[model samples]
Every structure is written in structure tokens, then in C-alpha cells.
Target chain A: MSNINFKNIKDRQFDAIVIGSGASGGWAAKEFAEKGLKTLVLERGRNVEHVKDYPTTNMYPYEFDHRLETTYTDKQINPIANSCYAYKEDSQHFFVKDHEHPYIQEKEFDWIRGYQVGGKSLLWARQTQRWSEYDFQGPERDGFAVDWPIRYDDIAPWYSYVERFVGISGNRDGLDTLPDGEFLPAFPLNPVEDHFRKSIQTKFKNRYIISARCAHLSKPEPIHIEQGRVQCQNRTLCQRGCPFGGYFSSNASTIPWALKTGNLTLRPHSVVHSIIYDDKAGKAIGVKVIDTESLEELDFFANVIFVNAATLNTNLILLNSKSNRFPNGLGNDNDLLGKYVAFHNYTARITAEYDGLLDYRTDGRNPAGGGYIPNFRNVRKQETDFLRGWAAGFGANRGNVQDRSGVGAELKTSLLDNSKWGNWNVHSHMMAETIPKEGNTVWLDAQKTDKWGVPLLHISIDYASDDWARRDDYYEQMTAMYEAAGFTNIKTSNDPRRPGNDIHEMGGVRMGHDVKTSLLNRWNQLHQCQNVYVTDGACMTSTGTQNPTLTYMALTARAVDHAVKSLKTGTI
Target chain B: MNGNRINRRAALRTMLYIAAGTMVLPACFRESGSKTIGLVNMTINEEQELLLAEVVETLIPSSQTPGAKELLLHLFVLKMVDDCHSPEDQRNFTEGLEGFAAMEDPATGTKFINLSPADRLRFLKQIGDQDNDKITMFYSMTKRRCIQGYMNSKNVMTDLKKYELIPGRYIADFKIG
Candidate 1:
């Protein structure tokens, strides 16, 4: 508490300025601070203290106003925000209401955001699957976007580095598509899930179903215990924020570590406007920020700046950074600052009832993560009609079937009967990869502006034709698999069909080998501005069918190491 | 009167009408009762509350276990409809409550609240099995709300659902089938 310097933010210069206190920003703060660099973390939202901020952590279902459902007024205010399953009565405080923060949706994009100090880290689904060699070398082989400068080998060590500190719970399934991570004890697969895994493995030669790799401390290591985080209680109400520090959140993990180092100066309500670029110096010197509360503009100088302000906001900041030398906005030499944006297609799903698995019933309560079937479509080659593949998440459970038709004592007896549990039912959703296109981009709306006087970002991204084709394939294959397993009442749906709802928005300021093609280089540094780095979702060259937070943490750690070495050599 | 004051008064009246309708008076203006009712900031009046209590009690009457009235599920139902349900649904609920209050037994023309237990049961069963959309909707909604309130009550959830705050372990297989 004493270490975090809240006062004198206008005076003291920092060694590094990290924008956005999220997954990548927290890592940037920790890595930079641990390396003896004076780091400044600017969070746009209000300050949310660790355990004190989790108000609904101990609340029961009955304690809520709507029994864990959002109010009608709240739903009306945040129609797009409340669409996500997490946007409910218990965790509504964590979400950014749509009325408060508005953006011009040129194509009706659901930009769900959490603007608190921890940002979306407090609201992220903690599925932590690592990308493999296939994911990194995707663009080069298929010829869609520019090639990723760093391969899987470059990031594997960093993945290990981040995974060791933040405990990942998963088994070492020897599959190259979804590479194994350094794991604690994996959560055990339930009887139905185990049966499905075996059946799937036996049926398909090239596929595997394993427990979803999640950033949960199943068995806390000594380092995790030293940080005061305990093992997961499997309560699964993590969107309320974990008081036990059982799951990996910036509020629980990295930001606290960074604060403990006495080198981090956290300034909440400081919304970054743009980067202050120096033409003669050929680098970025500082960032221009506006205080969210007072609406006062301020500048904080730093030797190096990391734009970890999520995917779209990172592009917004970079695109707004106008200078005399680079008039088209910062390092956007080929006008590629906010181009080739993509998101995971999350509309498609398959559900079925398995009457044979009645003997093998799963427990009612579960940790949020489900069994993950890695992308098996184009692992070796593009055998399918689609270009890329999709990852399917599997979950099976048993529920009570209360008799609703009858009234009186019979209905009460039917509901109260202990043996009224239904047969095992299984379901899975397709997180298909969308191709990054030149047309799908985000640019500043010339007409609209936010309350802070920044131009409202006009998002024009949607699912391409390949994404739709891939969805059909996902539905077909998944239904076939369920049928093979002797399941009945097979159902499939593609409702709420829209991009950006998956919340895995990626690739606006992408990395590439050539300076002409992309904004950022192989090291995630902007090509024109060497001192500036965009290592969040903005650095993704291709949208792989994996949960991207783990990859973002690894990339941020790797980029910070490169930046520190470059600083030592006086490269800037 | 101030414009804001008039608007606020109109809103409150509308809310009360939406909860109790013109047939019933507001709870605060009703006869002072000896029963210790926990006053919640909702539009449901005292008589309406008693009617709901009687109605829900008829649905799940006292046997070996506690009934809806014993669990005070009418209060839960009122709070839920007022705060949680949409304004459209709230209006529908209040209109339905008015209809329920106005309904009389076909045999003896006795008001719903004054009917004998068996006659009340038969009347409710007839209402529940009605072909008319309004009658069916009102009966279905009331039944569902009562069931939800009673089922989620502390006694029901703790005893039947066995909801634990912390399971401590992710056991793959449980003994219950």
C-alpha cells in the first residue's frame, strides 16, 4: 500500500508507461518493475481494491435482487453488454455499461468491455490454452495476413515463464495443435466427460479431448502460496472476482506483485489519449492522458511505452497519435494501423441427450472451464472446405426435472423427490477462427466523439464467408461425433450470430517481418516508433482457435524482455 | 405543485395500480393489522399481499413440510415481480391479480377468498385448465411464481438442493444417480 505512489504523478518521470491494467498491462508492470524500472500503470476506470472490491463474492443466489439476473433497467441500458452470460446481477459492477461508454458500431459489433482498474482481467473466462507452431506459422502457409515474426519456439519459453508464476491447471496431452503448458494438478474429468474423451479418441485418429487449460491454482505451488493465493474452491462464481485468489486475475495476481516491488505507480482514472511522438528523436517520449473524473489532460514522460490497452483501444490510441512526421497516425506507414481485425466465431453450438450415460452422472457444481477439443480440422493440412479450424468446448451435466404441468401436492412431491435427476446431457460450442481481412477494420468516426473528446471508434468487423463455412463444418462434425456416441435428441443452433461477442478481438496492429506490411515488428515494437510496443491482442497476426489471454501474457513478457535489453544497449 | 412532484406522484400511482390495480387500495392506506409484515419498498398493498398469501398457500398448503404461506413466499413473489420482472410483465401480473380477486365459485357464487378449501381447489383447478388465454396465463404465471418462490426459499434450497458454498474438490463422479 505504501509503495504505490498515487501522488506527484505530474512530476516524477517513469522508466516505462504501460497503458491499461489488464492481462498484458499487469505483466508489463510486473516485468518492468522487477527489472528495477520505475513503471507507471494507467487504468482508465475507477480503482477497485482487491478483496474489498469483490462485493458479491460471498453473496448467495437468494441475496441478489433478481437471483443473479440483471434488472430490466440495467438490461435496457446495457443491451449489448448484458447479452454475455457473465453480465448479471452478481457481477454487473465489473462490466462497462453501454450507455456510459458508447462506440459507433458501423456493423453492429458487441464491444463488451470492463473499464475497472483490473479491466477485463476481472471478467475474463480463465480458459488458458497455448497456441502451437501451427497457430504462429498460420499466415505464412495459408497466405492470408502477414507472417508472424516469432514462431511457437520463441514464445514457448515465455509461456513457461508466465505459467510458472500464474498456476495453470491442465494435463499434458501430447497434442501439437494445442501445445501443453507447465501445469499444476489438472481438474479431474467427470465420468461422462471421461467417457466422451475415450469415445472421441477411439473414433477419431487425429483428435483429443482434454480438460480445458485454465488459469486456476488447483494445487498451489510454493510461489503461489507465498503470494497469498489459495487453491480453487470450485465455487465457479469467478466473475464476481475471486477473494481466495484461486483464479488468475490482474487484481489478484500480477498487479499486486508489481505493487509489492515499490517500483509501480498506479494511476486510476487516467484514460490515455495518445502517444507523444518525437520527430527528430524518431521515437516515442511520453503519452498524453486525460483524467476520467476531472477531464483534465496530462502528459507522463517515459523512456519506453507499451500499449497494452486491449485490442481495439490499442488501435484507437495508436490511430489517434498524430504527429508531423507520421500524419496518418503513429506507425501506420501503409495506413495499416487498424486493418485486418478478426474475432472468434462463437455462435455455433451442438447439444444432445445421452441416455446411456445415466449410470455415469457428473456433479452439479463445476469450475467454469469445460473439456476442450483442440482444433482438429487443419492440423496437418487443409483437408476441409474451410481455410482454418475450430476449437470445441465440451460439458456434460445432470439437472432436476421438476413437474411443471401438475399443481398441488403431486407437483410438490415430484419436485421434492430426490431421485428426479434427469439423464446425462452434453453440449459444446464452436470457437471458430475468422480470417483477418483488409475490409474488417476499426477507424475513428469523424462525426461522433466520446465524453473525453476522443473520436468514437467505428468498428466494421464481422464474420467472413470462411467463418460461416467453418461453422457449418463444426456443426456437421460435432453432430456426427455425438451420433457416433449413441446420443439422442441432437440439436444444433447458430443464433445470436455475430462476431466480437466471443470477446477474443485480435489483430489490428499486427506483427510481421516486413515494415511495409504491418505496423509492429517481430519484437511487437512499432516499425516507425522503436520505443513504442503494442503487445496485447493488437500484436496477433492471425486468430487461432485458442483462448488468447495466455498468449497475450506470454507475448507481453517476451516483448518486455526485448525492450529491457534494447534499453540496456541504448538502442533508442 | 412542482412538475417533478406531480410526475413522481403519477409514477407511484401507476406503479401501485400496476401492482394492485384500481380494484384494491394501496397497502399503506389499508386497515392497520396486528400481523408483523416486513415492509419492502414495492407497490403491492396489504389486501393484495393477503390474497397472494392465500393463493400461494392453496397451491402448496401445510403438510409434513412447510407451505408457501409458512415460508412467506408471497413477499418473495411481490419483491421479485416489482424489482426483477419487466414493467410489461408487472402490469400483466397486477391485472391477473385483479382477475384472481374478482373470480367467484361457479356453484355457490362465493368470492375466491371466502370459498371452502375444497371448492377453492376445484375453482383453481378449473382456472388452471381454462382454454381462455388470459385465465390460463394468469394461472400459469401465478403458479410458476409461487413454485419459484417456495423452491428457492431457505428451507427448500438448504434441504433439497444441497447447495454448498465451497465444494473444495472437483469430484468427477458422485454417488447420487
Candidate 2:
């Protein structure tokens, strides 16, 4: 709480300014800095140093007081954050408190946000599946919002470029719908999972249940080793942050790499208010930032600005950037700045017991990444009742059953014996693609402002009939699969999950070939403002079934490349 | 300098108690408060500690491995009841302990604590199995906390459960014994 006088903001001018330090921002900063641009990364949260700041990384369950349960105060502070399984006592500090941060929810939107240097990158599930040609051509085929400006070939090499540095681990399952990527050795499936994989492969020609392609380094390459990352140790305590730099995080990988370049300047607790626009110049000159601690306003100039402040906030920032040239907001002339928002439907879960796997069990602690069944229903053509498809994350494991009843020596002996563990059980959850609509949007709340005086984002997004239809299909198909696999006690949960709970929210400032229909172009640059790139989740045109962070990274890197080239060519 | 400093371990312990459903009150508030002194505030005499320890030992006695008292599980129970449980739950548990102390063995005509280990076990078991509200509530609460503390103990988890912190590789398909 020390009050410090503001320095000259003009002195902090850079070639490029990236307003985030999460997945997208990290990559943008790295790419820009490596390309010899003096890049400034503005993170609106406290700096969390790698390994050192991961306080609970090496802690044992027995060492923890509540083992792994959230405190009453934790729930009281941020019930939304507590709703997420990752927001336990072990990693409560990483999540934002609901009381401290306020946003208007026209619909029930469980906006799970992390406010730190690494941001949600540290808290992400690390599932990195590539969007296929079918995904890129989805809107055109189905006649949805607007066609994506770019296709699979546009992002494929860039995906490879990021993957080489990040170190993705998976087997090359050469399926056309779910295209393979450059990978390290894949994690082997358990016997029950293997059985299911073989069964699915034999039964269906369309579906392929392969090991999930994740950011964890299964076998550290020279590039990963150079980044000081090692092989993942199957800890499954990734939410606490990886001390080994096992999985990719801004703190562990990209941000650090960017810093090592000597061309990157990281400014933490710099809450950006708006982009400063020059009407005559017809381009964004700089960004106005509010100091989170002292509430002092500072404006820094930059040649280029990459809006990688996650999805909703990116839209909020751009919508708030008003000027004489763009009264609505910067590059928001057509009122498409904060509309057509979408999030993955994670409401469906199917679970069943496999008594036949009594002889076998999954050994060692399984990490967050698991076996993935690529969407099979409507990959080639829209044959289903619904338009879009959903990807299923499948996992199988055995549970230890301690005797809760009885007492004395017998009970103690029973509990101590690992031989008396329970039978194997398999479970799968659906991550369905959400179709973006005009009604589902995020706009600035005119009434309320935060402590920093920035208007709060009013998010009004929900699932449509298509979402429900997908859930029904998910339940039906998964149940049948489990039944066919000779599993008993099969149960499918169709419990409704509120939007933003999946944390895969995208498409507020989406990219399209048409300038009126979208805010950003194919290269992720604003149509009117070439120097300003919005290459985070904000640039996503469609909410594909895959986890969006990897795509965001690739897009950020790709956008930086395009912007840098434009700067040299004098086009921007 | 110390005033601004936070004891992280103590803070973590407090959070654990809170998560376990125990509500610990501030030390400064003890003077102003009435009828809701936390277990952390209360000073249980040596005799009471010994009695609780003996009771836990009976509940989860040692075989070749360490018993409840050997692992100092009674301290965990005391801490949980004092720091974790709600005020109402604490009162119920306190009253239940008193009630348990009063119950006499028919054959020996001695109070529960005064009875032999074997007789005490039988009496406690019979009380535990009873449908009576007081006996059932007390037994279940005590047993649950006792077991939770014991099972999660460093020694137990390390030796018995064979908890590995760093399993270098995940052997997905292994034959279960």
C-alpha cells in the first residue's frame, strides 16, 4: 500500500504493446521480442515467478490441513471460482475473488477468470487439440454467423511452429477430421481405456479414441530443455503450477523466453482503460492504462498493439476505446465489437463401471490430460439433428475403497491394505462446440464502474436449442458406447452448466473476410486499423469443440508475424 | 515488523480447520464473547486428554502398526473440534463427551472411562450401535474425525498407503493384486 509518484509514461514507448501475459500475450511478446521489436507486456495482475511462486507444487496431501477442500471464506469470496474443481484451498490464491471483481450477467454466466502474470494459463486444463478443415469450413457449410477468414492450411504450419517450442505430447493419430500434429511420445492408456479404444476403432470407422494432445513435455526436446522444462512426472497437481516446468505456462515458458530476449518489458498491475486513438491518423497511437494500486492514469505510445487480454476483456477494452473517428469504439463502426459471443457446452457427463477390468488398474497419478474421442457424428456432413459436433474426454481408473464402517484393528488393517481397492470405472465428459448468435453478447455496463473507474462488462450469453440437442446426442451416443463396451451401471448426466464455466469463451471481436460482419481480418488485425491486432480468444470466429488456448497461441504468433511484416512493407 | 508479517503455516492450519467445518474465533474477541469459546481457546486438562487418547486407541487400536495415540490422533481430534467444528457441533460434542463419561458398565458398576479396556470397548461398541440420538451423534463425529486424522497422518499415508510424491512415469495398464 505504498503511494508512489508516477513516472513519465512517454518514456515507456515500445515498438509493440501486448496487453496481457496469459497464453496469447506470452506468445505475442516472445514473437515480437525475438523479431527485434521492443515489446511491452502489460499484465493487470501481480507478478508470479515460476517454480518459486508455486507454493503448493510439492506439497503432500497429508501436509495440507483440509487435504483438498475449499474453506468457507473461499466460497464466500468467489463462489464462481469455487464452482470450478481447480479452485480448491491448494490454489485459491490463483483465482480472483468475486466480491472484489463485479460483472453484470444478463444470463447466468459463470465467468471463471484468473488475474495474474500467467493468468489462466497456469490454471488451464492444457488440452491442445487442433481445429480441422471441417471446423474452419463449419460456418459456410452450416450457414451460421459468417465464414472464417482463414482455413486449416493457414494455421497448420503456425500450429507446428508453436508446438515445436511448447512441446506437445501425443501419438500421431492420422485422422482427417482430427488432424495429427508434431508430438513427443504419448502417454499410454490404461488397460480399460485401451480396451475401449480398440473397441471404438473396430466398431466405428469415423471415431478414433487417441491420447489427448497436451502441452506437457512427455520427452523433453532440446527446445524444451533450453526453456528449462523437464518431462512431466504424472503429478496431476498441475493447477498448483508445475515446478518442473513440465506443462506449458506463461510463467514457465513463453514469458520467460520473452524476458531473456532483453527486448521485452513486463509491466504488472497496469490495468488498461482504453486504446488512445488519433482521429486524423486513423490508427490507434497508444493505450491509456490505470495503475491498479494507486489508480493513477498513464498513457504509453506504441507503433503496434496486440489485444491479447483474453476474450471478454479484449472486447471490453476495444468497445471502450472511443474517439471522434470511432465514437462507438476503436474499429467498432458496425456495432459488431461485442456481439456473437459463444462458449463450449460442458453439461454432459457419462460414467459407468467396468467390472471386467478388476484384474487391471491404472497405476501412478493420472494428470489432467486424458484419452480424447474426436467428434464423429457430423464431421463429414451434417447428418445429425444438430449442426455442430462435440469432442468427448474419456478416462478410466480404479478407486481405493477404505472401510468407512467398523472400527479397531480389523478396520485399520482393511484400510491400510491396498489390495482391497474398488473395481475399475470409466467416465467421459463432452466439450461441445457452441454456435455463435447475435443475441449472445458482451457489452459495457452503462450504470456501474469498477474501483479503477472502467465500466464493468455485462455478459449475456446462454446455450441455444442446438446446445441441448448436442447434449442429448452426447448422452445417447456415450451411453450406447459404454453399453457396447460391456460396461454396467451406466449413467449419463445432462445437468445444465452455465455459460463461461468451461472457460473456452470466444468470438466477441471475431475475424471474417467481410469487414462489416466482423471486427478483425484474417491476419487478426482490425480492418480499419492495420497495426492493431486482436489475436487472443477475441479473434475466434467459431467456438470449435477443441480447447481454445492452443489456437489462441498460434493465432497470436501468426498475427505478430503478419504485423511485423506489414510494418516493414509500409502497408500498415 | 512482526505486526505486518503473516505466519503462513498457522494461516494454512486455520484454513484447514475452517474447511473441516470448524469456526475458530479471534483471540482478542475471547474477552467480549460469551458461551462460544472455541476449542483452541479451551484448556483441556491432562486427565481429559488421556481419556480422549484412550478412547481413540480403543476405536482404532494398533495391530503391528501404530495406534491412534501413537500417532497423536487425539491432538488432531482436539484441534478439529476446537478450531474446525461449528459452535453448535462443538457444544454437542462437549455434552456428548460428558454423557459418555457418565455411562456406567453394568457388570463392574464403574463409569465408562474407569472400566477395563475390553469392557470399555464393548460398552463403546454397544453405545455406538445404539439408535439413541446422543450416543450415535457423538460416536459418528468422533470416529469420523479420528479416522480422517489417522488416515491422513504423515506416517500412515507414507507407510501404509505407499503415497508417492514423484511417480516418474504413469504405467497406465498394470495388473491389480
Candidate 3:
């Protein structure tokens, strides 16, 4: 509602500018600032302070007027946003309305996005896992996608760096597919889950189940304690934002550290549209931003520009920054700027009912982070059906007394008593890796534009035959595993949901050895433009089965180091 | 001038209090023993809520621990049905309740509530097992609502389940009584 005023413009230059305040951008800002660089971080959404701004963190269900209800108005108005299970009255304020910033869905792309300071980091599932050698060496092994410029060794140290900072809690299993990492002590598995784990391990030679690797600080280290962070309160209400600062998020961790440095300037409600490329210097000098509130154009100059505006948005900005030298868009001469888009192919689910576990009960208050089965297939030897592998996250617990469905005195009695805890329920969802195909690409929609008049990202993606084949195999494997583990009345279902529905959007400006084929080199610096770097999910060369946020943080930190070193060496 | 300003401020405060009182107070202070009522506080009236409470308690009665009614699961269901559910869901629930209310035993030609506990249980079992539209609706709606409400409540979470803030050790085997 504020009026645009060009007279208020005061151009300021910085050593580096990061175009986002989410997972990667926050890390970039912290790393750059810690390295003595004056960094300017631009966030498209409103500033959200931790604890103070997390409105629903400690509230009970009954306290809310809507209690977890999704209204007909919500579904009718924002169908795309309403499709997700997370879209509820309890947390509706976190999501961006589809009407405000609509994108053309070439297919049915459920582009679940949050545009606040912390972005999707506030709403993420927090299941952290390390990418093993198999993930890094997948493309070359399968002959499907371009080989990564960097390998496991290159990213392993960085993963450790991130894990130590973010405070991941998990049990270390020396599995080849799912590697171990620097982790805080793992959350204990329940008795039923342990039974399943033992059963799976005994039945299958390589297959195993373990507790989920999560970003929750199980026990705060000295570094984390110094940052005023505490251990997890076992409050499952994380998506609302942990008021305890129990989990890793930009609002809770990196940005606060950056602020303490006093060398970082964070500007919220500023959307970076494109990077201003200097043709003669052969470098990106700065970024042109659209003031979200006032609709005014502004430029912030920097020696280095870090494009951490998620995967699709980063590519959209790159493709829109067209100049005389690079008419195809800045550093997009290879026409591979917005190509090789990949997302986790999530198509598997298993549900079952258990009997004779009546007295057993778990604290229904805590979130069921779920148990994980480390990837075993194609680890030691090759498998015929699928080249890569997938991991399964499964959980089981006693059904609540309120599970009594019928009405009347019987229903009432059934609902109240914890005596009938015999009825147990088990659920498992599989995260399968997909090959990064050139055809699975995102392009700027010439027809559609946002409120700021910038072109919208048009995503055109679908799972390949290999992905489908893997999904089918995953279904069979999961059902068999559940059955073998003594789960009764087992049922399996697959939705064949769209790519972005997983909310694990990756690839596009991928890392690769060949400059001609890839947009960025190993360091995530643009092949042609050295001063500009991308360290979001955009730099993902391959889509691994694990959640990608932790990896994004690690890569951003690594990229910051690389950028700083390059600057000193006069590489730009 | 000072007296006038003070009077105006007091008047404004009184107006605000009256407006808020009219809106919220009535819902909180309902007629104490009203049995047959439509809706109150985005849920069934206290009397109907009590009936639902009794019903849920019977379904999952406390042998070892507190039952559904004790956890006020029926109130939870009513709240969910009235406020949380979609408009279509609300319609379905009302229709389902009506159908249930209209049900009569063939032998005596009497309403379901007139039947003995055993007879009621038998009738409910038959209806529930067959997955009859009305019965299924009642069953699923009540069950899901009860569980969701009870599990999220502090009584069930803290007292019944005994939620430990930090369970440091991961024990593979624990006896289930």
C-alpha cells in the first residue's frame, strides 16, 4: 500500500549480494559475513522474527476456531495450495495465495512455495539424510544424465560442515547407499518400530531400518548453545515454527548469526528479477530488484552475486537477464539455463492394521518422524529393473481410543478409554530418485507474469519410464517388506503425483564437468560469468532420494568459500 | 475540557465492552441443563454433548485407562463437525444424525434409544459391519474426530501416554502389558 518513491533511492555497493533468505541464501549470508565480506541478503517475503512471529507454535487444536479444517472457500479459491495435507487453517498464513502469484501449469505442477523470510524451511519435513557415493556417481553409472563435476569426496566434508552447524540427529549406519554423517544422538525408535527393524534386517541381507535423520538438535552442542538454541521439546508442531528454536531454520540460525556479525544487511520484501551483467567486464555487476511493497525498481551493486532464489526462481531470473552479448539470457548461451529439472519421484505408500498390541501406547503429542530403511538395492551389485535406489520411511504406533467410528454410547465409551490400544496402524512412504532428463525442463512463461510484471516460471516435467519402473518395483518391495514384518491387512497405493508436489524441486542450473552441456561448474559459478554463483537446489546435478535442504546449505557454504578464494585470485 | 474527555473515554470503553459481551458471553454461559438444543459455541449444546460423551465412552470404555467420554471426545467431535469440517461435511453429518434418530427396532416399533444396551450394541454392530451409508458416516466421522481431538489434548498426551520430554536411550525391547 506504500507509494513508490524514486527520491528515496540510495544506491549502496557490497562485497556480495545473496538473492534470497531461505535455506541457501541464509547460509551464504552467514558464510560471507563470517569471512569478513559485507553481504546484502534480499528476501522477497516479509520479515519474520523467530518465536515472536511463529503465531501458532504452542497453541492447541481446540484453541483454534478452524481446528485443522480446510474450508470450501479455501479449496475453491486456491486449489493448488489446498491440495497439500499441510494446507490447513492452523497454518494457512504461511502459504502464498495462488491468486497473488499464479504460474501456468503446463502439466499439473503443485508448486508448493512459501515466500517469507525463511521460506519453506519453516514448513519442511526436517528429514535430513546424506547423499552417498552412489548418488554422486549415479549419472555416470546409469548413463542417463551428465556426470557431476564434483563427486562424493568433494561434498562429504561440506556435508560434515553443514551437519555440525545445523545439528542433525541420527544413528550412524555404515551403509554404502545411505552414508553416515556428523550427527547428534538419534531419537529413540519405539518398540513396534524396533520389531520391524529387526524383522527387516533378519529377513533381507542388505536391507535395514533406522531412525530418521532430522534437523532437530537432540542435544545442543557448545556452538548451538552459544547461539541461544535449545534441544527439541518433542513438540510435533514444527511446521508452525518451533518457538523453542529447536530446529534449524534461517530465522532461528544462520540469519541471526549474520546479524550478530554486523556486516550483513538483510532487506525483506525485495524480489530480485535479474542480474545486471556488464558485457565489457564479462561479469555480473549487480542485481535489479522489484520492491514488493511499493512496486519500485532498485539496483544493489556487489562484487559477487549469489543466486539462491530456490531452483525454478533462480533459473527464471537467469533466463530473464537478457543482454546484447547474451541475448539468450545472461550466461545462458548453451540454452541449458533452465533444463534438466528433476524432483523426487514420490509414488509409493503402504498402510496396515496391527492386532494384539492393546496396552502399548506412545506419546501422541510428539511427531512421528518415522523410521527409515537405508537404500540397499544396486549398492554392491547392479539390479536389472532400476539402476539407482530409493529409501523407505516407515512408522507404526497404537491407534487412539477415539478411533471408535460409530456414534452413540458405544462410540463415546470407545473414544474415552485407552484400554483398547490393541489396534495399531503402520504407514510407509518411499522417496525414489529420478534421472535428470534434459526434457524435464522449466522455461519462463511469456504469456503469464506476476504482480511485479516479471515473467512466471512455467514448469514442464514428468517422470520418465525408468522412474515409473522404479516406482512399481518400490511398491512391490514395500508391500512385501510390510507383510514379511508381520503387518496384517496391508494395502499399497500410488497417486502418480506431479514432480513439484514433493516440494523437493531440484536441478536446472546443474553442476557438470562439460561447460558446453552444463550451466555452472563444480564450484556453482556460471561457466561464462565468474562473479555470479548459484548454490540453491538449482545447482543439484542429480536428484537424490534424501531431502535436499541440508545439502543446499552445505553447498552454499562451500560456494561462499570458493567465491571468496576466487575473488582474491582475481578469477572474476 | 478534561471532564468531557474522561466521560467520552468511559463511554467508548462501555460501548466496546457491551459489543464484546453481546458477541462472546452468551456462548460461554449457556442455559445450564438444556438437553435438546441445536448448536452452541460452534458445537452441540451441553446436553447433546453429554449424550455424545456417554456414547463415545461406551465405544471405548475405560478398563485399564480413561475412556473417550472422560477425555471429552464427543465435545471434540462436535467442535470438529461444526467448525472445522467443510459445509458439505456439516450437511452430511446433520443428515446422518437425522437418519440415526429415525431408526426403530422392527419388533417393538420403538426408537433406538428406547432399546436396552445389549440391543443397541447389536444393532450398532450390524449397521457398522455392513458399512451402511448412514452408519459408516457416523462411525468414521466420530472415530476420526475423537482420535484427532483426544490425541491432541493435554490430558491424553501427558497423563495417559506419559510423554517424556527426552527419552535418551533407544531400547529395542520393552514388555507390552
Top candidate on DockQ is 2
TM-score, model 2 to reference: 0.90
What is the Cα-based lDDT of residue A513 in candidate 2?
95
Range of the 10 consecutive residues with the lowest summed lDDT in candidate 2 chain A: A1-10
**Per-residue lDDT of candidate 3, residues A453-507 (tens digit):** 7998887888778877887788888888888878898988986677788888898
Residue-wise lDDT of candidate 1 within A215-258, one digit each (tens)?
Answer: 99999999898777998998898999988999998889889899
Candidate 1 lDDT over B85-141, as tens digits, reads 677777777777777788777788987799877777777778855455655665677
Candidate 2 structure quality by residue, lDDT tens digits, A1-572: 12323375556678999999999999999999999998888889999989999999888887776666664445656779888878886898899888878999899998888889999999999999898999999999999979999999999999999999998888898888888888988888788888899887788677788988899898999999999999999888889999999999999999999999988888889999999999788788899999897788888889999998989999999989989888898898899888999889999899999888677777786664569998887888878878988999998888878776766776677767676667677899999998999999999988789999899999899888888899999988888788878888998887566888899899889899978899889999999887899988888899889988889999888889999999899788
TM-score of every candidate relative to the true structure: 0.93, 0.90, 0.84
| RMSD for each of the candidates | 6.2, 5.5, 6.9
In model 1, what is the error at residue A20, expressed in angstroms?
0.6
Model 1 chain B weakest 10-residue run by lDDT: B20-29
Residue B36, candidate 1: alpha-carbon lDDT: 23
Scoring only the A-chain of each prediction against the true A-chain gives TM-scores of 0.97, 0.98, 0.96
Q: In angstroms, give how far residue A239 of model 2 lies from its true place.
A: 1.2
Q: Name the better of 2 and 3 by DockQ.
A: 2
Put the candidates in lDDT order, highest first: 2, 1, 3
Number of the candidate with higher lDDT, 1 or 3:
1
